[model samples]
Target chain A: MNYIKAFAPATVANVACGFDIFGFAIQEPGDTVEIRRRDEPGIVIADITGDEGRLPRSAEKNAVTVVMLHLLKHLGRTDFGCEVVLHKNMPLGSGMGSSAASAVAGVVALNELLGSPLSRKDLLPFAMEGERIASGSAHADNVGPSLLGGFVVIRSYTPLDIFSVPVPEDLYCTLVHPDIEINTKDARYILRNEVSLKNTIAQMGNVAGLVTGLMKSDYELISRSMVDVIIEPVRSILIPSFNEVKKAAIDNGALGCSISGSGPSMFALSRGIENATKAGEAMVRTFAEVGIDATMHLSGINDGGARVLESY
Target chain B: MNYIKAFAPATVANVACGFDIFGFAIQEPGDTVEIRRRDEPGIVIADITGDEGRLPRSAEKNAVTVVMLHLLKHLGRTDFGCEVVLHKNMPLGSGMGSSAASAVAGVVALNELLGSPLSRKDLLPFAMEGERIASGSAHADNVGPSLLGGFVVIRSYTPLDIFSVPVPEDLYCTLVHPDIEINTKDARYILRNEVSLKNTIAQMGNVAGLVTGLMKSDYELISRSMVDVIIEPVRSILIPSFNEVKKAAIDNGALGCSISGSGPSMFALSRGIENATKAGEAMVRTFAEVGIDATMHLSGINDGGARVLESY
Candidate 1:
């Protein structure tokens, strides 16, 4: 039943204070997964378009291949065979969950091609396994939004419970990606080993506010709750004009603004589409003024992640 | 124009994870205040009951008198004169906002006695000032809940911003007070200065779950989200049968259970009134089985803090 046709969606990761534990997919930015059945029983990955010369074809180091391999092994079909071609539709290592997008797209497409051997919920751990291939640890923030869409909060590490929050009708998101790169690993290493209790409490309050705001669908509360006192202070040092652009975006009437993930990219939220567009423009102008070329996206809240683009 | 009438309601302090920074008032277990116009401009205090002579009467030590003094000074009325009587409603230091209840009752009563000179919002600071007289520092976890009904969260220290969260319709709270006293200061002093980064991140995740749960009105999510990794470990040591009672209440169908405020008191939540009553009984039985007598409250979520019982 391995149809030669399949598709997977793209995602935006590092949602403000949520860091690696939250992410969501965008409608426009997505990957296509077209697979075909073969007599061989191992996963073979081919990186087309979006990934130029940097991606590996080997199944071992590849995130998607690892997950597919695990899936196949679990099904007692280690000899099962399929070749997954990932049209890397999103940028790689751009703080936008580019690699995760690839992994998710591959697994989702393969699963669909195999008549959905695993449920989407059952597929998350495999996706997370793919994430650990690069980040050295599994982080759910990006995987969740990529899979479930909308605002998400992770409640535990050992159990890894993910909670979806109600998105406000007026909610709009703006993403600004500068033409530069900062590896998440380097950024993570730079963080201090310890934080004071006072700062911890402050950060927790902000985190609580952010989650509550999303669930209540209170755009104003969501905007006010976006303050981050922990990772942002240290992480922002890697990105130029982070503060200036944030200030300009808010001044231009954005509800809240912060680094999108580990960035050369940043994000802002607004109560309406018009405000989101304007905020995006404000960010673009601010980043350009600081000598960083940037592009902005004014998008609405996404309610679905990766899905079958044309399922039977 | 002194109406000689005052009132203050019960408050839920240290609400959930906000610990020492959040609280809100209920219409029950409230205190009543009566003030009389005096020939002397300075404040005079008299007629305190329900404290059984274990309370202070000195104007400097009395929470009500201190608040009246602050209010008079704030209003630029040094000649302000009044005689006061207080009805001590809620039990003192029972982790039910006893201190804040008194402070709020005194200030609310004073506000009315002075011909409603200040609105409720304007009166919060002075009531918080009264709390400072006893706690040695200004903290609103007790005062905020005593003044405003429903749920609350506090985010900052300087200038003090309080966030009011929407309570779920099916929300029910059950409280169990053991016959013992464990001071807030003692609970605070037992806590370690440093927390593990891993634990802090876990705490952040749980907080996110909690806030979202409340906003979504997801009782199951709220129940699952009610966990403490930072302060509970240190504070739970002070309360006997803390774990036993918690296990019993939850096993008997409580949504979630945790120590109330500091110590010597604990509370559980449920989705329905019947379940709340069952939770209360379970809490009482658990404590009694461990040879500790306890008073329990099976109650609904209070939305309004205080009202004029009888205005003339």
Candidate 2:
């Protein structure tokens, strides 16, 4: 195939008690990337959409293009050339893993265009490279889920151990994105370098409980385990109407609610579509009451991460 | 029944990565308690064995007697009287959960003697009360598993949410109790009140992985996840030849090795009895080389926690 187009779904990182370790993919509000082989000796960003001309066209500066460059280098296909186009359907800095979606889509499209040389797991390093350039840290919490789908756990970073955890089919997720921006770096900087040992133990317990709940398909256990003791207390301050939105979500029957990744975006899990929809509406209404524009999306857990849309 | 006897198995708490949150019951080296209805209206430690008279006989001072008192109070049977006897088959202050076993046995025996007024789940509070008196903290990591059997996760402490996690049938546990004592109070005091956020996240990842490993029965994942960065570094110093023992266990094909709870006792998990036996021998030899006498027990995960031995 000479050309390929792929779609990568958005993801929610941190997952409350599992900061820097857990994430899950969602179905709506994702990015699409298109790639075409060319006789030229270098990759170029030919066209972009949905970004308001704000994203850089230079391959060196863009997350997707940077990922493509790294993929080529890894595959020893540096001589290969391609024309790339990105459609940024998700808002930037929304805590919905917008950058991860784009990066995943790019590598997936490039991998397909090269006749599928790399396995799906092999694409993770390239996607993580994109994350490093975009977020100033090499974290797999976002990219792992956005690429592998379902719930992903970054078991260890030193040896790059990542695992795809099971998620129940009945579980629905709701994301409410307020029209505000909170830089990932700033949100991270707000956290304390040291955490109380007591809180750390509590967080570990909850994280283990959350994993068990997911594996057992226990909604009540999930609700009880979806608590953050170390990061959310500090980072939630950066987002407008954070507490009110969370309260609205819980009041409307959400299993649990928390800031999606950093802030300006929040998400909740529920057992059914009805509860998810009501929780999303409650969150939106809470943000609207605070004079903030918001958008909401309801989805089941995304089992398929990035995938080829078309081939030519 | 006028008299009842119960046996409570030993427990390995903390489980390396899950300090104060995780534990599992083992099959050997436990405690036995005997309870007999008395004409008087107060609980009393009528006799004791295997403790060399180091344990207090007063109901207010002894963990087993204290648990009985609380159980009686909770059952609105303060008028009820009991003569209690405790046999400490396991060594005290060895991090083998000696007190938890005694507490569990006490409650189990008393509950049986009262014609089973309290259900098994209702017995947790009494066991925790015993723990509070013995360890100066209301931690259920040891007591929960010792009473409930199998693997137990203390999801939360405020509301006392505890879950019995599944244990693989073939998994074997090996514990080596060295001839030394590390008081739980001193061991806890040695811990740093604050932990680095990076290490905290790492610990959380491992805890989640360990839970997943237990659920999925993945031995390699359990081996990789059985790591403790928050507490073991400091507590290991209190146990002589700690590193050598752990290294020997691992070298002899242990799936994982770490301090059983605080110090002086170490445990390892393996998939087969052969590996467990070898690991146990290696641990004993390592301790012996350092002039520290040790005893080893090899057995599978105990699915039955505390049970009535004989009724009269």
Candidate 3:
């Protein structure tokens, strides 16, 4: 019997202000995980590439492999395994959910290949475990959006609260990658252990305003509320021209622009494709102006995360 | 012509966990402002009650009078001079929107009495101004919900992104007003100026969850997210049996409970009026067990801040 195939898109983690509890997926720069049934009845990750030097081929170090183990353990099926292939589509270390996107693709594809035994809701914990393997923390911010697509808010980490927000059809995302690499562990270490009360309040208000901005499709509010008082500043130092690129995207009519995931890549959201293209180009130009060469991609929110493109 | 005859509810400021922004109205207890029309286009406030003679009855020292003046100035009209009598229905020095609720009522009443030139949205700034006179800081946490009648999220103070959440129709707010009072200024001072980044992240996660809870009508999520790590401990100290009552309310099927305003009063929200009644009675009972007498009232979201009761 031929098993199912699934593809999970790349996710943007950290999400500017929300740290580990908020994220969204873009249309381009995603990973594909192909899973096929075997005489074995568990989950397994077969191949890894594009991150040969960085990723683990032994399945123990790979996030996707670990999550599959977690899923099988949770289901009381200790002897379940499947041959999985990870097509590393996006850059290895581009701050665009390079690890999480791959992890999401793994678990989602495996779940579907298992006759869709577990629903998407049920797949969240397994996906979160995959994230935990990569960053030493189980956070759903990136995993949720990568698995579900569009904007997602993660309310909890232990037991994940993942939900999708309605993305207006007109909204599009512009991404700029500066070909720079910043390890997630290094980015996480740069932040302070404590934050000022004033900053915390400001961050909360910004989060609130961002929600309203997304809900009302108010580009101006979205632009204004994208200001992060916490993670980005401390982490962005590792990425060259991060601030300049953000400013450029905003000046180019993007609603709000900020560093994607842990940095080196910046994403801006705009009202339509035209604005999104302009936003992408502007970020690249600004990065170039700062002597940093960057690649920009403009795309809209993908309504579905993983599905069949076609079967041969 | 008579300018006005009724009063508006005093808003409880500093809604728990939503410090500096978020408030709700109490109908049983309120501030009554009586207005009398006069030929001169000059404002006058007379006979301020329940303030222990500490308030200025002569317009200048009175906050509501100043807010009324703000409304007139905002409208660019000089034809609103009238005699304003404020009957402070709720207790003075209570952690409520004693001044803001009055301000909201006077403006709402005056706006209706004066042929409704300004809108409901226009009244927020004036109410905030009224709060500033008492608290010495221009904040919208109290007046926004007071005027709008529901849960509110204030995105920022400088830009003033203030709006209300469409509270679920099934939600019931049970309020417990203890005899003891906590000064708002003192409550504000007692709070720790610095917060840990970990706590702040947790708080932000809760805030995000709470917003989603209200939108999705997920009472469990709302209850889980209604936690405060920054201000609640210090503020709750001023309120008698705050913890016991909150525990009792939660045990009795109330979704979640927290200090209503600054303190001395706490509220529990539940899925239905029956649970709200049980929760309200349980709160009062819990307070009695601790030798603190609290008058608990079961009420729904006002939905009407300061509307005409009979328009005679």
Each candidate's fnat = 0.57, 0.90, 0.54
lDDT of 1 at A257: 85
Candidate 1, B87-152: lDDT as tens digits: 886667677767777777778777776778888767778888876776566777667766766777
Candidate 2 per-residue C-alpha lDDT over A1-312 given as tens digits, one digit per residue, 9 for 90 to 100: 799999999999999999999999998879999999999877999999998898998999999999999889888998999999999998988899999999999999999998889899989999999888888998999999999999999989999888878988899999989999989888887889999998998898899889999999999999999999999989888887789899999999999999998867899999999999999999999999979999999999999888899999
DockQ, prediction 1: 0.59
lDDT comparing candidate 2 with the true structure: 0.92
* Residue A311 local lDDT, model 2: 98
The Cα error of candidate 3 at residue B42, in Å, is 4.9
TM-score of 3: 0.92
Pick by lDDT: which candidate is best? 2
TM-score per prediction, in order, is: 0.94, 0.99, 0.92
By DockQ, who's the top model here? 2
Clashing pairs in 2: none
Q: Model 1's CAPRI class?
A: medium
Q: What does the lDDT read for residue B100 in candidate 2? A: 95
Write model 3 residue lDDT over A1-312, tens digit each, in one string: 355455677777656678777788888778877766677665556676666556777766678778877776776767666787778888866778877787777777666555567887788888878767777667777778888888888766645566665666788888788977777777777889888888888888777666666766667767677888888778778877777788778788888787888877888888888888888898888878878888887788877765554222
lDDT of each: 0.74, 0.92, 0.75
List the TM values for chain B, per candidate: 0.94, 0.98, 0.91
